[model samples]
Target: MWFLPDGAGITNWPKGPTELDALVFGHVFTILTTPLPNNQFAGIVRGYDNLIELCKRVEKDYFEKVLEH
Candidate 1:
């Protein structure tokens, strides 16, 4: 899932495809901005909070396509 805190990049999404398995995006100091959904999804942690909870497997894929866009 793409964590776009800046709300700038990550556009031109697929034409028809939905529900992506893998994420490609960016965030800046994500912990502060991303709110813990205070409604139905509130139970789920957010931002660095959530990242801390989930077992991370970061390979840091800096592909040209995502970067150039």
Candidate 2:
């Protein structure tokens, strides 16, 4: 719902005032609160530990099973 970006000021990632579609995207961090009923917000979380693993695999040089997501 609210987070600080690596570049600039704080961010509140909600496209609308509705309960749904609320997410925060930061350059170095991501924060999401108020879970959705469908767990749709799941897997969208970005953790610091994932940086190495993620940076190691780039879309330009990587492929995966469709079900991986």
Candidate 3:
């Protein structure tokens, strides 16, 4: 797995050959893909939108419960 800093160039996914299984960059979660033309070797599993919703729901629930206490 590759844990890259946010804004790192991932379009040319993988960058090079290795035993990479997954990649986490910014709010994007990508998995290794069979190398293809255009340097496309990473497939996005989840993007910011999905993560935002999850975070929102969790925060809302936690805050609501806390306020009830």
Report the number of the highest-lDDT candidate.
3
Estimated TM-score for each candidate: 0.18, 0.19, 0.28
What TM-score does candidate 1 reach? 0.18
Query: How much is the lDDT of residue 66 in candidate 1?
Result: 69
lDDT of 2 at 8: 41
The 10-residue segment of model 2 with minimum total lDDT is 20-29
Q: Weakest 10 consecutive residues, lDDT, candidate 3?
A: 21-30
The ten-residue window of minimal lDDT in model 1 covers 20-29
Look at candidate 1 and give me any clashing residue pairs: none
User: What are the clash counts of all predictions, listed in order?
Assistant: 0, 0, 0
Candidate 1 local distance difference test against the native: 0.36
lDDT tens readout by residue for model 3, 1-69: 133333666665564323332122222322223345643424334344444443344446445689887
Off by more than 4 A, model 2: 1-31, 47-69
- lDDT of each candidate versus the true structure: 0.36, 0.34, 0.40
lDDT string, candidate 1, 4-50, tens digits: 22254666645432234133212322432466554333333343443
**Model 1: CA > 4 A from native:** 1-8, 18-42, 45-69
Q: What is the C-alpha RMSD of each candidate to the true structure, in Å?
A: 12.0, 14.6, 15.3
